[model samples]
Every structure is written in structure tokens, then in C-alpha cells.
Target: MGVFTAADEERQRGVRRMKTIATGALALMATVFVLAKWAQSAGAGSWTGYVAAAAEAGMVGALADWFAVTALFRHPMGLPIPHTAIIPTKKDQLGRSLGDFVGENFLSGEVVRSRLSAVGIGSRLGAWLAEPDHAERVTAELATALRGALAVLRDSDVQAVVGEAITRRADAQEIAPGLGTMLEKVVADGGHRRIVDLVCVRAAEWLEVHSDSVMDAVTGGAPGWTPRFVDRKVGERVYRELLRFVTEMRDMPDHPARGAVDRFLSDFAHDLQTGQETRERVERLKREVLGRGEVQDLIASAWNAVRTMIVAAAEDERSELRVRARAALLSLGARMAADGRLQGKVDGWVEGAAVYVVTTYRDEITSLITETVAGWDAEHTSKKIEAHIGRDLQFIRINGTVVGSLAGLAIYTVARFFGV
Candidate 1:
């Protein structure tokens, strides 16, 4: 049985009071009938016959109406009469019919569209959302949802997915041509000159500081048959030449070495683009780099870092992400509230979505009503329905009694006047 609410109890009480009044009317009619018959038996007056007839008819009408009303909820006097207790016996049938009725009339796409269009929910919602408080509340809710989603996701799984995606994308796409094009552009724009200058400067400074080391290296590599003094003097001479070359390259922008370096880079860029062997070499290098555990770890770590940053931003109310989201929502809401065309578009979208749901799931939507009613206790259902409308039904019995009495009196008066 469904829970009997306080409101239902109040309605039941009202029904009881109306039932008492209707029963009292029936009793009064019976008492009048008896008194009228006794008066007629004592030869009181001709009007006594009319009063008896009226009272008798009133009692008959009251009992007939009462029987009809009672049969709807239960059998009269608990008898096993056919067609009695209509609701209890046919509850399932009634429920199915109710569901079918609702599906056909209420869940139809046309009905849903018409109702939603009339509501103008889009513009109204926009007006409400345009408020600062509403926008802030929505922003908070969105941030909470984002944070919850991030919390639910495992970082390791996300990292794996991100790593695999990047690896797959890298493997699928050829990078040598793109790299060659980028390098060629850099050289043409003289962007490579700064790097050349940096390298030259560094080399010159290193040679100046390591002159003794350079001499020792040259001396060590010389022939052993040569005299030690001769090797040492040759080493010192080689070191000086090396240092002077580096210093000149650093100072002169149009040095032969600098031009040679530029030509080498330009040729390498061309080979990367047009030479199959060069492209293959680059591809092999790319595979080797991607296959390294450290590189993969670095890629996965990047995703982890980004995920942590986003989650943190989502959790913080004062974060730029949240602020921007709130501002965007407020702007959208304001636009929707003020722009009639935007309002119409929003309304159309909402209406279309509602219509789609109702039309697509009409049966499923209606099944809820049928299933809920079927689950309820049939006796409780009957009682509840009676409680809701029983008070009004009692009035039918009272009306029947009064009307029956009037008809009876009129008939009796006509009979007496016509000498029938």
C-alpha cells in the first residue's frame, strides 16, 4: 500500500461526514414514510397519501444511488456480485488504459512542443541566469562537476591513454618534410645566424681558456720518433692556430667558416626534404627517440602535470578558469535575455530536444505510470480514489433523494386531480 498522507486522512474524514448526512437523509425519508402511512391508516387526510408516496420514492432513490456509488469501491454488503468492486477487480486494466491515454495525448511530440513553446522557458531561464547570483551559482556547480570528473579519473590510466595517442599520432605522420620546411624558413630569415654567433663565441672563449690542454692533446698525438722539444713546439703552434681561427670566426660575420656552416645547414635542409636516404635516417632517429623509456615517461608526465593543473584550477573558486567560465556564462545569459533572435534559437533547441525525447521514448515514458499503479496495492488504490471523490459522490445520493421525492409528489398530485 502507498503511504497514507495527512491530506488523504483529511479527505477521508470529509467523506465520512458526507456519508453520515446522506444516510441520515435516507433514514429521515423512511421515518416520514412510516408516519405518513400511519396517518393515512388513521384516516387523517388525503395529503397523507401524497406524503407517503413521496417518502417511499425518496427512500428508493437514496438506496439505488447509494448502491451505485458503493459498487464502484467494493461489493454491496460484501456480496460477490458481478461488476461490483469495479476498481479493485479491474485496477490493472484501468492502469493500462490510463497509461495508453497519457501516451497518446500527453507524450506526443506535438503536445510536448506546444506546451514547451508556450512556456518560453529559454527567455525566462536566460533572464534568471543573467543575474550575478545565478551566474555564480552555475559557475560553482560546473566547477564542482569538473573537479569530480577529474577525481574519478585515474592519473595512470589518463597518462597511458595520452602517451599512446601521442605515439600513434607521431608514428602515423611524417615529420621530416615539415622539419625541413621549418629549418629552411629559419635559415632564410637569418634566425640561424644568432645560433651560429653563439656557438662561435663559445668556441673562442673555450679555446682561449684551454690553450694548455689543447697543446697537451696535440703533443700526445704526435709521432714518438720526433724529439720531445720538437713535438712540444709543434703542439704549441697548433694550439695558437686553433685559437686564432675561433677568434677570427667569432669577430668576422662573413668569415669563410661561417659561410661554410651556412651552406652545410642549407644543404642539410634540402637533403631532409628531397633526399630519400636523409628522410629515412631522420625517420629512424625519430623512432629511436620515441622508443626510449625516458622520452615516453616525459610525454606521460606532461599529461599528468596538465591534469593536476586543471584539477587544481577547477577546485579553486578564484582561479582564472572559474572566473572566465562565470564571465562567459553571464555574458551568454545576458545575450539570450536581450537578443530576441538568440532567445528564439534557444527556445527552438529546447523545444526540439523535448519533442525528440517524448517522441523517441513515448512508450517508456508512459510505462512509468502503468508500472507505478500496478505496483500499488489494489485495495489501497480503491480506498484512496474513493477518499478523494467519495464526498462528492455522497451528494449524488442526496440529490437523488430530493429529486425522487419531488417527482413522486407531482405524480401523486396529478393522479388525485385527474381522479385516477
Candidate 2:
């Protein structure tokens, strides 16, 4: 009772009623055969002989059909006859055959593609998504998915992965040639002039403020034999020359010192591009910068910032990221719904993806069916199947009884006409 569904119970009752009717028919035939034989023996009529023959055939047919039907589920009359209990004994084989049939026919790539293509999934999806409410639902679902994904990720693992990727990329690419090209472009465009002017101005200001320090440095480097006043005068002259040169460079754009600074930059840029020594020096500097603990920390922290930004955007309905995503989806949906070419492309993609999945996992799918069947108890399975189709099978028995009687009557009538 626990195993049977309510519908199955109803079917079982119907089966029992049919079985009773079939058995009654068989019993009726047996009684008729007995009466007809008795009458014939008493020389009642030739019709009694025919009736006995028909009744006898009906009984034989009914018993044969009853055994055939019962043999499918269990042994008839509890006898362990060979080939009886077919379903229970051969359940595993049947399951395997069913699985193989499905795998070969339904799960094939061609079948999957054909079925999905006929469904027009892409066009239907586009039509559904074209609606504002549907678009909003999709947008919300996407946001939730994004949030869930970010939440599941460990920050430290993400940080480490980001750091390693950045480091590896940087290590693989040589920066000197690229840097030189940029420098050359800047110099050609006179972008370096402002930088030079700023430096010159800053130097002039520093020299003006530390004139005493400059004089002392010059005098300290003088020969000890020189008079202190001469050394002091020399120091003053040196300091004045340096200050005047910086002032000229700062004020005059066409000054010789400015021209010299430009020439120096031009030469350095050229060396960066073509000189091996210059490139090697740049490479060394690059390695040093990349190898620093502070740079690694900066790279790792970038992932944290990006993760935070994305999570915030996903959480906020009004955020630009979500708003734009929703808008874009709506637009795409509308376009796809309107454009046939796009619809075709989308359909093709979907079909190809579906076909790939089915082809790749067909074995697994079939195994699931087969294994589930194999796990069922054989006797239980037999009973379950019987509950479903046992009522219909009773019709076969009923038909056999009626057909057998008619056939017997036809044969007897032919025999009497032939005078047999």
C-alpha cells in the first residue's frame, strides 16, 4: 500500500474486478461443457455436442491466457515453472536495454540539436526577455549571482592569484623599448620642456636660499695653502656662476643651458632604444622596482579594492554598474527579438552548446537510468509494473475466451457440413 500510488490502488481494484469476470467466464464455460456433455450422452441433440466443443475450447483458451499473464509477474499457482516471473528475473537486462535505447536515440548530438532547434529556444527567450518585467527579473538574478560568487571567493586566495598574475606578466615583458618609445614621443612633442623649466626654477630657488651653504662647500674643497679670503672669494664666484646659470635656464626658453638639457634628454632616449648598456640598466631598475615588498603589497591590494567595488555595485540597485547592465540587457533583448539574423546566431550557439553537453555527458545520463533501475528490488519492481498495466492485460484474457468459443463453433460447423 505504501509503495502504490492512489491511482495505482484504483487500477489495482479495476484489475481485480476484471480478473474476477475472467475467472467467472472460465467457470461458466466449464459448467456449460459439463451440462452439454451430459446431455449429449443422454442423446439429447447434435447441438449439445457443438456446445460442449465450444465450451471446452473456451476453457482451454482462458487457462492458457491466465498462465501467460501471470507468468510475466510471478509463478502461476506458486509453482516454480521455468520462464515464469519473467519481469522480476530479467529486470536488469530490460533496464540496460532501455538505457541503451535512450542513449542511442534521444541523447545523440544530432537528435538533441534537431529538437532544440525546432523548439526555437533563442527566439522564445528573446521574446520573453524583451518584456520589461522579465528583463528586470533577469537583471536581479544576475546581480544575486554576482554577489554570491564574490561572497564565496576567499579574499586571500584572490589576492594571491592577482598578485601572481601581475608579477608574471610584468616579468615576461621587457619595459625598456616601450619606455624609450614613449620618451621619444614626449621629447618630439616638446612635452619635456615644461618638466625642464620646472626643475630649473626649483634649482634656482634652492640655490638662492642656500647660497651660504654653496659658498661653504666650494671653500671647503679649496687648497689649504690659499688665503682664507681668496678661498672665500673663489667660493663666492663659483656660487654666483651656478645661481646665474640656473636663473637664465629658468627664464630664457632659448638659453644654451636649456638647449644642453634638451640634447641630454634626446641622447638618453636614443640610448634607451638602441644602446645595450642602457637597456640592461633599465631592465635592472625594472626588476628592482617590481621586486620591492611595497609594490607587491600595492598589487595585492588592487584586488581588494576591485572586489569591494564590484560587491558594492551588485548590492546597490541604483549603482551605475547594475543600472547599465539592466539597460544593456533590455536593449539586447529588444534587438534580438526584432532581428532575425541575431536570432539565428543565438539559436545556433544555443543548439551547439546543448549538443555538446548531451554528447559529452550521454554516458553519465544513461548510467543514471540504468543504475536507478538496478537498485530497485526485483519483486517490488514486478508488482509496481503490474499495478500499472495489469488491468489492461485482463482484457487479453477476456478476448481469448470469447475468440476461442467462436473458433470452436466454426470448426464444429465445418465438420458437420463435411459429414465428418
Candidate 3:
């Protein structure tokens, strides 16, 4: 059988047992009354008459209670008795009342606060989080959640956001002053000397490789009427001077030509950072560079590479990102377990968050209970409730029967003592 069906059958058996006990109690009381009355009619002792009276009263009380309880659940003996079968007949109204009762009493803001405070939620959270294993579990779950969120974001959406951000930033800020200031610092710190050296070396190598071309260019610039020999001689002299100048720049760190070039660059750097005309020129150059299609393509390519790397990292189990995430989790767990101050801080955070939610959305949350109850089929709701609580209520009937009988006997004895 299904689980629910088995539970229902169990509930039904309980209900039947309760009814049987109640009926049996009433029948026994009635039997006592009948026996007592017979003894009184046969001229038995006054004690027998008193006993009959008490039993008779007890029987009435028991029967009355039985009828009252039976009427709540069903019509007695299947007869159309007024006000009987109260639950089945007025189930809808009962459901609404129950819903309203729960909403007002159990779901109210004050009730929730009182209940939570009584439970010592903050301390409980602190105690739970103080465990290393619990903290590690929480951290792992958080990492998984972050990974899922990252995975859900589309590449196109990210690319658009990145592109717009870059464009906006570029449009809002002047890049030249920043660039110039950085260059000025690099120059002052001798950071640019290595670059200068590299340039000199490359130039010397190029001149050595293209000596013939250099000679041709120098001679070609000469007048057409000049003798070929004279042109060749002049070209050779010019080529040799150019090659010697490059070789000196490359080999001699303190060459006069090198010092002049360095001084010129230092002055230019200062002007780029501070001079108005120089700044304006730098700004113009920046605008021109940023306006180029190549610059835009480079920015887009950077975003693409970053996005691809992130996606790959998110997908890979052995990724540095994931490894760091796991290690962070374990470390957090260790800290939470060892440090009481940290545990308290975490607990406070949790309490604050929970209190905020309860204060802000309490009304809506409470209303859900009422709304759910109102939406339920009343008969089904009543049955469900009865299934849970009816067995317990049966005990009330049993106690009443036993107590009423004892009380009746005591009253009868008191009345006899008073000679009533």
C-alpha cells in the first residue's frame, strides 16, 4: 500500500478505538444504573439506592458527552440531526476560521520574534558554524553557487557590457596626461634607457646590413651633372659617417650624441607631463590613437581573451581558480572552528540578515499561511487535521467519563450525609 494510505488506515483505526472506548464507558454506566434500580425496587439497602442514583447521573453525563463529540465528526446513527456532522457540514467556515486564527496567533510579527528569541537563533548559529566541517560544507556550497551563476552568464552579454564600459571610460577620461606622467616617471628612473639601448643596437645592425642601399640613396640625391666618381666618393663618405655614428651610439654608453638624445627625451617627457602646448599635442595624439579601428579591435580582442579564460577556468576542475576556492573553503572552516571572535562575527551577520528578512517581509510571509489555508478544500483540510489530532482528543473523552463518574458518586454521598 501507499504510505499515505497506510497512514490513513492507522488514523481510522485510532478513531474507531476511541469511539469504542467512549461507547463502552457509557454502556457500563448504564448497566450499573439498571442494576442499582433493580436492587432499590427489591427493597435493597439505601447504599444501593444511592449507588444507583450516582451511576444514573454518570450515565447521563457520559451519554451527553458522547453525543456532543460524535456530532462534531458525523451524524449520530446516520440520522439527519440538526447541528450534527458539524465538521463535514461547516468545513469551509472552519477552514477559514482556522486560517485566520493561525495567521493572527502563530504568524504575527511579535510571535515570530518571540519564538526566534526563545530559540536563541544567534547563539545556535554560532555554535553550528563553529564546527570546521559545517563551515567547509557551507563554503563549498557557496563556491558551487558562484560557479553556477558565472556559467549562466552569456558571453555575448558580457562582451557587450565590457565594450560599453571601455568606451564610456575612454570617452570620460583624458588619457594623455596620465600616459605622460607615467612616461616621465619611467624616464626619471632610467627605465627608458634599456629601450634606448635596444633601438641603438637595432639601428646599427640595419645600417651594417644595408650599406649598399644607404650609399645608393646618398648618391642619388646628388646633382645630375656631378661626375659619377665624385658622387660615389661623397656617397661613400656619407655612408661611413652614418655607420660610425650608429656604432658609437650602440657601443659607447656616455657618447655625446647619446647624451644629447637622452636630454632631448627628458625635456620632452617633462613637457608632455607639464607644458600646456605639449599636453594639448599629447591629447590630440591620444584621440587619434583611440579613434583608430585597430585600437577598438585590440580592446575587443582583450575582452574576448579574458572571457574565454574565465569560462575555461570555470569549467575545469583542476583550474587555479577552483583550487584557490577549495583552499579558501578549508581555511575558512579552520578559522571558524578555532576563533571564537570570528564565529561571533559570523553569527551576528547571520542574525542580522535573518532579522532583516523577518522585519521587512514578515507580513507577506505570514499572509502566505492564511492564503494557503483559504485555498484548500475545506473537507480535505478538516480531515487532514483530524487525522493528526483526533486521536489525542479522544483521551479527553475518556478522562471526562472517568472523572464525571467519581464526582457523581461523591455528590451522592454528600447529599445522603445531609439527609437529602
Best by TM-score: 1
Give model 2's clash tally.
0
The TM-score obtained by model 3 is 0.70
A best-first ranking of the candidates according to their lDDT comes to 1, 2, 3
Quick one: best lDDT, which candidate? 1
Ranked by TM-score, the better of candidates 1 and 2 is 1
Off by over 4 Å in 1: 1-69, 205-242, 375-377, 383-420
TM-scores for all predictions: 0.78, 0.73, 0.70
lDDT to native, each model: 0.91, 0.89, 0.74
Give the per-residue lDDT digits (tens) of candidate 1, residues 58-157.
Answer: 9989999999999999999999899999999988888899999999999898898899889888789889889999999999998888888888998788
Kindly provide the TM-score of model 2 when superposed on the true structure, using C-alpha atoms.
0.73
Q: Note the clash tally of each candidate.
A: 0, 0, 0
Q: After superposition, how far is residue 345 of candidate 2 from its true place, in Å?
A: 1.5
